[model samples]
Target: MEVKVTSSTILPSPTSHHSDIPLTIFDRFAANIHIYVIYAFTPPTPSNADLISALSKTLVYFPTLTANLSTDCHGRPCVSVGGPHEDRGALVVEATVLSKLEDHLPLTPSPDLRLLHPDAENPKHLLQVQLNRFQCGGLVIGLTSHHRVADGRSMCAFTIAWGKILRGVPIDPLPFYDQPWLKPRNPPLVQFDHWGSEFIHLSPQSNEFIITRTDVDPSEITNLLLHFSPDFITKLKAQTNKLSTDKHTTFETLLGYLWRKMTIARQLDDEECTTLSVSVNGRRRLQPTVPPEFFGNLVLNAYPKAKAKALIEGGAATAAGIVREGLRFIGEDYFQSFIDFGEVYGDRDLVPCFEKDGNVLSPKIEVDGWLGLGFDEVNFGGGGKLCAFLPTWVPFEGLLIFSPSLSQSGGVDVFVSLLEKHAVTMREISHSLD
Candidate 1:
């Protein structure tokens, strides 16, 4: 589908800048990557002007987004809300498609999806949005944001807040950035060793683990989306828990099943080790629970690994058990330890361990989930469910993302990025309970 650019404008935030905000320890580890999120609505969608008005109002609540990604005096990443003489704005692009959105139902991730959003690598603003209008009066909103500024949960809350503002609803328990709890203890208690798992030192004298990129043909990489029905999940849980009486959550069961299948599809050697980087949320697990509306990255990645032979032979049930335990390990103490590490280790040369992983993470898998996020309740566009929503094209392989199904209430939509051959093999065995 061809997209014609209509008009482009910068929408400035309406708020008084108090001061620049520093990135918390939780925010330091996020990669410097931007993602394009596409949300399409059918005909009778709101006018572009109306959407902009709502967005402007929403920005009043999240003024930090209008600012730029800047480094503080100590060269640490932080949100530059503004100084005495500085003011910034977000980028908004208006586009038009000559085809009806219904004709392109169930939109999948592809290079063309990038056309619906602003350039993915924009550095001027933390938040950028595009409004794509279809010939049939349908509308698709494309948004791109810097990953270092916020996490999935934060973005979801911002979206919901924008929706509420658009519908004339009060944003009860409004979003907040004042997190006094993140202050470091007087006597910083560094309980856990985070040298290798999360952060790696970047000092010249220290031997840092080097990351190498896999140079594979771009054409060989593909993104495959799969919809797992509710009934299939019920059977997967039953089959996975046959040996033990304990029931597992849908996430755990699916994580295990997907890991096993992906390993088999990759056809790894029996002795080769495979690792799954599970994203763990510390909001509720922290000592003083982080508020749901608190806007920032409050998460970490947990690693679960085993020899290929053991993982395959252990079956999804055993795999699920590994995943369960991996998540169980990241509790209040773990969060406090990471905070303590950041408190005492601040200003030291630091970088995320996973940042060096190359294009093809064959024996390694990275996962991010967006299930049960209440995104379905957003009614700003057409006063109904979004026609389509998913990640744009990603270059990495062995990456997994779980999203709530747009059409199925209790179902899941799995997004897999892998080598074309491996993707083909994974799809062939996607539905098997074994």
Candidate 2:
């Protein structure tokens, strides 16, 4: 279907929060990428004008979203908020689609998908929105936010605030923006080996040297959403719990199960070690817990490695144990050490292996769990709720995102990107689980 942009406008932050803000180390290492989330609504959708008007007012409180990103004297990323005579505002595009909304139920990366988000490279605006209206009176709201400015939780907070404003409700308890809480310790200490097995320091002549990009045929890759019903999850949990004496949380259980299944689907060599990198939110994990509303990136990766044969042959409990063990490294001390490490090495061009392009260090999978982010509760206005939520596309192979199903059946929607042949095997494994 053809989509055309009719108008573009800027929505700047409120005049009150006009000031320059420096990014934390956590923010500096963020992928410097744009994350796109698409929300669909049926007929009787909220008016685009009304949504834009609400968004403009919402930006007043979230001025950082309207800010421009630049490097400081040390060449570290920081945001210039509300500069003099500058339009520090998010870009909003009004667009229309010729076809029905169902045509793109599960959004994927394409030239058309590119229209749903702001420019991925060199995002002129930290935040951008595209209001796409289909011929059937349905609407799809697309949001593209720079990862360096906020994490998924922060993005959800912004949406929640916007929804309240659209509904004429008071935005109680404003977001906390203090960055000192995560500052490095006085005498920076390198406690645990934070970059041990999971991260590889890139060096010339090193086998793990990084690549910015690689060419792969579009036809050779497949992106699909696999649904796991609540009942199925329960049954799987029962089966897994039978193998271990300790109980496993749903997140760990599901991740372990998926990791094993993906390993089998890939049909890798038995002796090869496969790693699963899970993003752990550091907001509460830190001592003197960070405020839930504190914006910016506050996440760290937890790497759990296992031999391919063990992962495929071991019960779900064994995989879950590895995942749980990986999480144990995310306590207060570990986070403090990580911050200190960043403080000392922030200017040394320390890039995470996962951030690079081309092949990962080895056969690996990365999962981001968004099951309880409460994005589904965001109501723009009227009674419309988000009917569907998913990223526009996967950035690389072996990346999987777990999102709560829109149906609210206590199930999950797994969005996965893998090679075409492996994707077929993954689909078969998903079906067998059912």
| Number of the predicted model whose TM-score against the real structure is largest | 1
RMSD of each candidate?
1.8, 2.8
Q: How accurate is candidate 1 locally (lDDT)?
A: 0.83
Model 2 regions more than 4 Å off: 16-19, 84-88, 102-112, 118-122, 195-215, 359-362
Which whole-number lDDT from 0 to 100 does residue 171 have in model 1? 90
Task: List the pairs of residues colliding in candidate 1.
Answer: none
Enumerate clash totals for all models, in the order shown: 0, 1
lDDT of 1 at 184: 72
lDDT of 2 at 252: 88
Worst 10 residues of 2 by lDDT: 353-362
Per-residue lDDT over 1-434 for candidate 1, one digit per residue giving the tens place of the 0 to 100 score: 89999998887756555456778888888877876788888778778888889999998888877876667777877777744323367789999998988888888889788888877644456788999999968888898887788888888888888888888888988989887777777798988889878887776654655555675877889998889989989999999889655689999999999999999899999999999998888888887788898888888988888999999999888999998888888888888888889988877767888776778998999999888666655668555457777898887798899988887565898899989988889989988877
Cα shift from native, residue 154, model 1 (Å): 0.7
For each candidate, what TM-score against the reference? 0.96, 0.91
Model 2, 1-434: lDDT tens per residue? 68888898887566644456777777865676778788777777778889999998888778889888876666766787875535467889999988887777655444356566655445677888889888877788888898889998999999999989988998888887877766788889978775543244655745645444554666566677888888988998898888898789888888888888888888889999998778888888887888888878898887789999988788689998899998876778877888898777666656655566563323878788887887877777665556787777654678889888886675888888888788788888864642
